[model samples]
Target: MKRPLLKIGELANLANVSQDTLRFYEKHGLMRPSARSEAGYRLYSAQDLQRIRFILSAKEVGFTLKEIEELLALEVTRDEKSCQDVKSLVDEKLATVTQRIHELQRIKKSLQSLSDACCGGDEPATHCTILEALSDHDAGSSLVGGKHHDLIK
Candidate 1:
């Protein structure tokens, strides 16, 4: 049975990505056209469609293009160790995400303390405690650590 080859536009439509996206993937060596028409149009096979889906799914899960490339390479050489390699990559990403969450939480707490210190008055900002704390180096350091609630008072 002959497999049907799809033009670039057709594949893009099926994959819900722009033609430029396909080109970019090609440029990045993440994907390749199965063949080219005599008219110079890029053509793809069903296997290409599956590969595009895999790329998109990995992206949705926060994998960078570099990481996705590693994953694709792993897929091509599957063995008993492949699962362990993938798990290690995911665990690294999870640790990074967890660290970022902690940093953001600390930032949020600092901002909340600054907001709570302010009276929200309509008066001029010349004597605002929030502004004053921001200008003071010691207070600013405390705010960054989220331990300056008492200092603001």
Candidate 2:
């Protein structure tokens, strides 16, 4: 029995994505339709549906589109080796996420310190510590770990 080819609308509906998103994926070569109808409408097969699902799943797991493209480029001919390769890719992504988390934490601390410096009282804005700190290039740079702490006035 032949599986019916799905039009772009049907595939987008089934995939829970907008038709424009499907076109975007297709335009990026991330997901290509298996064929086109005589009228030039994009047509997808069951395999295409699965591929789109994989791409979406990867994105949800924090894979950038370029990383997903690299993943898609990986040729897996054997199960054991393929599993190892996939694991390596996952490990790399995890490391990237961990580094990003650390950077965000540092930024969070800096922002909190800045916010704490402001009393939020009825005092004139001219005397605001937060504003003063911002205007002081040396102090501002040091807050973000720049090499200007020694230059603080």
Candidate 3:
């Protein structure tokens, strides 16, 4: 512990996060109270600042709050294998991202074909290829398949 631990506002500023974010992290169990001043203000140690930095970095790489919380929980428990678990979680996230990219490509191709068939400015509504493609289909009809439609929804 260091002398004169920082107050909540000072800690938030040092962490480059808002006071609200600090509160949210506490609520989510990612952060814990260090100590309290005589008037009931929260105090944070040097270790708390380091933890906040780690959390923000993780978030920037697409780790959700829950994921960060899991990591924090592991740290709290002094789990030796937590580093391995982090790598696993990152690999899983990368796979999900790749899948999403492929799905987006499919949706883009579908929309392009339909849209290219109709000139945006000159086409009459009834004769519009986009309109025809859409209107000709029944309920649940889309140029794109169900998976891409589900994404749009």
Candidate 4:
């Protein structure tokens, strides 16, 4: 039996992505239509739909387009070593996310300290400690791992 092919718009609706997104994926070499109709419309197969879903899932987890391309290549190979390589890629992403979390935590602490320093008064901006701290060169250093121990005081 012959497999069914879906038009570009149909596939986009099934995938819940814009038709332009599908075209972008094609341009990036991440996806390809199974065939083109006589009317020049792009047509995709069930396999293409599966590939697109995989790409979207990878992107949701912070994989770059380039990385998704690598993953697609790896998926085709389907060996034990390929599985190991995929694990390594996920590990690298996890480490990056972990580092970003730490940096954000530090920023949150700094912002909280700055907020606590403010008296919340509606009087005038001239006497606002928050504004003063923001203008301080030393306070700016806190964003780059510099000491902010005295920021609250």
Candidate 5:
């Protein structure tokens, strides 16, 4: 006879994620493991464990669950096209990382300037220079230079 299946809670504990996170992964198509319990509990397999680990690793590299699903789908196809697709995905991820790095560098410079301004003459928060710098001027007179507006938007 086979052993009984693990419930969602047990499987989630084993995978080092909350049960809700596992459900979210399933909902997002990053994981499509079978649900065998009619009472509506989620059942998991060994492959599910590996897939969860794969999701965690992908997240560490900044891949969204959508990206993970795309990558996993390609991997399962077992075709020469899989290699080409993975390469394309990696290239896209690299460009995203590079863009993020540039944005971070710009943010760092802005923060440094703000900090330096706030530190000038040891002014108190009630009259904070940084706060003054952050105030919205007339659009044509804004001091943000060329920083992208998406962060505020």
Candidate 6:
């Protein structure tokens, strides 16, 4: 026999989320309890716990709630086309992460150059090369050999 449905508190404890967060998920259409008790308490199944775990996992992987919703929708359909769609979304996310990594690398190198320029011998702030580079309009262009906007944006 299957386990009986769990009330909100029980599900929250099992799922490791607060009852308010569960209600928030429900309000946001991310999830809903499987049923309600006669006294109007929310009730959930084991499947709901699984769904909450999936939601948390997706979030940890940097998926936006909107993206997670799309993933969940695709999962519910469980069709070949949906699998292809989900793969495409994953590819897009990977590309975005790659681009962000590249951007961060550029920023790191630029900041490193500024740090290198500073002698760090208790020089006055006015004479600090790091501060000078930050204040100067053409700093990144000279230090990193990239345009200012390239380093920052």
Worst 10 residues of 4 by lDDT: 122-131
- Candidate 5 lDDT, 8-43, residue by residue in tens: 888788878998898888888788656567877678
In model 4, the runs with Cα more than 4 Å from the true position are: 75-153
Q: What are the per-residue Cα lDDT tens digits for candidate 3 across 70-129?
A: 666643225656767766766776786686676566555546656665566354543345
Q: In model 1, state the lDDT of residue 83.
A: 71
lDDT of 4 by residue, 1-153 (tens): 978899989999999999999999999899999899999899999999999999998788677999889767754246876778778876786777787677656556556656665567443443245435444534535455454468775
lDDT of 1 by residue, 1-153 (tens): 988999989999999999999999999999999999898889899999999999998788577988788767754235766778777876786786686676666555556656665577454443345445444434534334343358554
Q: Model 2, stretches more than 4 Å misplaced?
A: 77-153
- Against the unseen true structure, what C-alpha lDDT does each candidate score? 0.76, 0.76, 0.72, 0.77, 0.69, 0.74
Worst 10 residues of 6 by lDDT: 139-148
* Model 6 residue 16 distance off true place after TM-score fit, in angstroms: 1.4
lDDT of 3 at 15: 85
lDDT of 6 by residue, 11-126 (tens): 88987889998898899889998999899999899899999999988787577888778767754256876778778876886787786566556656546656655667354343
The pairs that clash in candidate 4 are none
How do all models score by TM-score?
A: 0.52, 0.53, 0.50, 0.52, 0.50, 0.54
Cα lDDT of candidate 6 equals 0.74
| Candidate 2, position 111, lDDT | 57
Error of 1 at 132 (Å): 30
| Deviation of model 4 at 9, angstroms | 0.5
The deviation in Å at residue 147 for candidate 6 is 16
What stretches of model 3 exceed 4 Å from their correct place?
75-153
Flag the better candidate by lDDT, 3 or 6: 6
Clashes of 1: 0
**Candidate 1: global Cα-lDDT?**
0.76
Clashes of 5: 0
